[model samples]
Target: MVPQLILVTAFTLYPIVMTHVYSLFEWPGFGPLDRFVGLRNYTRILADELFWNAFQKSFIFMAGTVALQLPLALLIAILLNSERLYGRNVYRTLFFIPVVTTSAVIGIVMRSIFASHDGLVNNGLQLLGLIDRPIRWLAQGDTAMIALILVASWKWLGIKMIMWLAGLQSLPVELYDAAKVDGASFWQTFRHITVPLLVPVGVVVLLFSMVDALTAFDLIFTMTEGGPGFATEFMELYIYRYAFTSFAGGLPQLGYASAAGVFFGVTVFLISLVLSLLARRASQVRR
Candidate 1:
């Protein structure tokens, strides 16, 4: 426990504390940190329309992930958990493969898969006569965001599925037996017993999915570069753009970026706190 605490303090707490401290200064990420701006950076962040736009987009991504990704994963998990299914292990392995792969590498592969005209998806769609011409998935703002969401859903589906599978596996077998004795249909058993029993795990998955959506940067960066004109520019990309990407010899806005990071972190913390309380309540209700 001592070694773990030391590691946490050195790696996680240290960076977070330094991020908050950096937010108070007008540092250019290097050389000097003499200038102090206090709350000016935070104020500037609040006033920045681009930040607000990215905030909205971040929530949009979060909503999409929660609505689409989780359900799909849950369905897959339920299917894989069925005792009647043959080769369930093989299916689980195939699905979980993407979750373990590096997001950047997946993004690179997705870039080619979604490319215009000759791209795999487009070509397949064309062959199927779904459209007369190929859709430019990454060349447009709305479509790029949609593509990002779809890719993210596919990439993360396995993780949430595994979480759901774990929860499903932990459910009391006697409950199912009683449901069977009561002549309850599969849907009835699922709705009355399974759903309520899984609420705690669902809450955990929800929190993680939301945080992942909020901080998703590398894949979007590697794939879209925040382009088709800021279409897929999420909060993470917003911070990276300011912190790392510079234009015309301008210094990086390290202070401003740190402020944004702190803001996002606080937002995540608050949401997680609420969700955690809800999870506790859910567990209480179940018991």
Candidate 2:
């Protein structure tokens, strides 16, 4: 037990400590600690316009993921769970494909689809007379963010759907039968029986979605690279730019990047904590 505890601390605590420690210095991930900047790094993050833009954009991303993904996933899972539904396994496998694939590969395909000129989407839209000119999806500010949200939701919806489906499948058949015996309408049974039993799984999925939304980096980084002149700059991309992008000729401000990372980590922590408390309340209510 002690050895396992040690392993957990070594893996998790070490990285966290290092991240916080590194945030204090503008260490360029190299030879020496150039300077102890203290809170200067944090101040820079607050002053940075791009940082603020990314911060606000993250909320948009989070809202979009939750609004569009989870409900759609729940709907799909319910449909799939229906006794009359056919070809359920085939549909499940198809939906799960994107989640199983690497984000990098998905990004490549999405980039092509979203290309400004002669891309599949634009071409199809033009053919249908929806737009006279090809809309620059990844290049436009709102469109770029929307595209990322759509793609991210598409990839993750299946995961949530599968979880909800499992919960639905595992429900006590007796409870449902009793509801039917009592002349409960389909909606009533669903509301009184299904929802209460499913609260635990819903809580789990909510926690996961909150974390996933907050920490979403790979999909945004790959699809948009926070591009089109910082229009879609996410926190991760902002950190990457500060840390890696050579500025004023050669010097890179890696310490600033660590500060940005700290901000992101803090935000995620807060969101997770709030959701956890909310989930507990929700579970208790269902009880």
Candidate 3:
């Protein structure tokens, strides 16, 4: 615990303090933090239309991840965990391959695969007569948003599946045995036993999924670069661009970026804290 505390203080606490301190100044990621314009960065961030838009998009992405990805992962996990399944290990490995692969590489590869004219997506759709013409997936805002969600869901699918698998495996066999003896149907057993017991795991999964969706950056950066109009822009990319990319009209805004980072970080932390308390309450109720 001593060593872990030291590491946390050095890495997490130190960075957070520095970020807040930097947010109070007009620093250009360089030598002097001379200009001390307190709270201006936060004010500007709140007033910025782009910031709000990006924040909204983050919520949309988060919602999509929880609503779409979690259920699919749970379903896949249940199927793979079934005792009657053959070669389940092979299936699990194949499903989990994306989690281990580099997200940037996957994004770059997926971009080409979804390209309009000659891409595999378009080709396949045409082959199946799904559409009369090629669709520019990354060129449109709505389609780009969908692509972002799909890529994110696909990348984390294996991880969430594994988490669910662990929870399912930990469930006591006697419950199922008793259910079987009572002549309970599979769905009835799952609803009354499996679902109720997995509440704690569900809470953990919810927390992780929210954090991952909010902080999604690498694949998004490589895939669209927030293009096709700022439609796919997320808060993480928003902060990175301000911190790194200098505009022709303005200098690089390290302070502004730091403010945005702190703002979102606080928001996420509050949400997580609330969820954690709820999870605790859930555990108590279960007991």
- TM-scores for candidates 1 onward, in order: 0.95, 0.90, 0.95
**Candidate 3 off by > 4 Å:** 1-10
Q: lDDT tens digits, residues 1-287, model 3?
A: 99999999999999989999999998889889899999999999999999999999999989987898899999999999998899999999999999999999989999998898799988999999999989899999989888888888988999999999999999999989999999999899989998999898889889989998898899999999988778988999899989988851477889999999999999999999988988888778878
**Ranking by TM-score, best first?**
1, 3, 2
The window of 10 residues in a row where model 1 has the poorest summed lDDT is 240-249
lDDT of 1 by residue, 219-287 (tens): 888988888877778888899888887841498889899999999889988998999999889988888
**Clashing residue pairs, backbone N/CA/C < 3 A, model 1:** none
Candidates 1 and 2, the one with greater lDDT: 1
> Candidate 2, after superposition: displacement of residue 231 in Å?
1.7
Q: Residue 151 deviation, candidate 2, in Å?
A: 1.0
Task: Give me candidate 2's TM-score against the actual structure.
Answer: 0.90
How are the candidates ranked when ordered by lDDT, highest leading? 3, 1, 2
Q: Compared with the true structure, what per-residue lDDT tens digits does model 2 show for residues 1-287?
A: 99988998999988788888889997777888768889999998899787899888887888888889888998899889987778988998998888988887788789999899889989999999999999999988889988888899998888999988988998899998888899999899888888878887888887898688767777778888887777778777778777888852477777878889999889888888887898788768766
- Which is the better candidate, 2 or 3, if ranked by TM-score? 3
lDDT of 1: 0.90
Q: How close is candidate 1 to the true structure, as a TM-score?
A: 0.95
